[model samples]
Target: IGGGSTHAWCQVYLPGAGWVEFDPTNGIIGNRDLIRVAVARDPNQAIPLSGTYAGSPDDDLGMKVQVNVICEAVAGDSMGASAS
Candidate 1:
């Protein structure tokens, strides 16, 4: 997630509609770009420090999330283009 962000948002429960999810970041109705790597009962249960850690949890650790999409095609490259 290079320029992307990681957040924990709650889902609203409607009486007749059941559970509905709304993304406040993009202002969309459903989960389109949302990447669900892990799932839990609540956000509190989710957010456990992952990624690279040196020595121990108390020691210096580095975490990185990269979200890169090949937006354009290169002249000689064959990777292809990506869409948003």
Candidate 2:
């Protein structure tokens, strides 16, 4: 979403706090604005876009996808703040 493409985030498990989410693209430290579509150890395991096309090579004009993200405020949640 930062550079007009699909954004990626990560999650790390802590000793006592459990698993924490981090969005490097937007500097977000929580899941307030993120959706857990898939979990994988390697980035390739989670392909954002994939499909098979059937038609003439010249007839293919390519494909385009548009994503919109809507975030809502959570009361008493300070972890949503951007991490430094």
lDDT by residue (tens digit), candidate 2, 1-84: 453456578887888989999888888887886766568888888877766778887784544665566677789888678888
Q: Using lDDT, give the best candidate's number.
A: 2
Extract clashing residue pairs from model 1.
Answer: 1-65, 1-66, 1-67, 2-66, 2-67
Residues 1-84 of candidate 1: C-alpha lDDT, one tens digit per residue: 221567654568879988877767666455666765557896666875546445865764445766565467669886765666
Winning candidate number (TM-score): 2
What are the lDDT scores of the predictions, listed in order? 0.62, 0.74
| Segments of candidate 2 deviating more than 4 angstroms | 1-5, 50-84
Per-prediction backbone clash count: 5, 0
